[model samples]
Target: MFWEALGSAVLGLALAWAAVRRLPHRLPARAMVLPTGAAGALFGAFLTHSALGSAGLPVILVGALAVSAASLSLLLRPAEGLRRRSATA
Candidate 1:
């Protein structure tokens, strides 16, 4: 259980780091990275807990990581456009 949690955390951080790196220059605010990643981690953990029932640590970890990445990417994408529009306005 401890290892599973640790793995999930690491995966979340990695996903967050990747998202931060990939963010557009217009949206490259440090304030945006932490919250987005933290949200992704929490959501991934919750989804893993609900979907996998605690067993199958590997599957749970992968699923959580993927969901976190996807969620972060989807959430940030619209924000990029918004920031661009606001900047130009």
Candidate 2:
């Protein structure tokens, strides 16, 4: 269980990093998803797979729903933005 949690955490962070890197340059900052979502999704997936996998429809449905909601929510957050000033330091 310890290893599983660690793996999930690593996976989540990696996914977020990948998304940030892969996001297109032309997209508005707000349109990009945050990496934390990826991490949360990973942790949620591990939980669902640990013991709840055998549970009935309700369990599966709930897990799936939660994961989807978290993952999508992260993706929906506005990407970070950068601004430029006319004057130099």
For model 1, the local distance difference test gives 0.68
TM-scores of all candidate predictions against the true structure: 0.63, 0.44
Give the Å error, residue 3, model 1: 2.2
Error of 1 at 53 (Å): 1.3
lDDT of 2 by residue, 3-40 (tens): 44455555555555555567645323523444454447
Which ten residues in a row are the worst by lDDT in model 1?
76-85
Task: State the C-alpha lDDT per candidate.
Answer: 0.68, 0.53
The clash count for each model shown is: 0, 3
lDDT of 1 at 42: 60
lDDT of 1 by residue, 35-78 (tens): 66656766676687787787588877777777777766665545
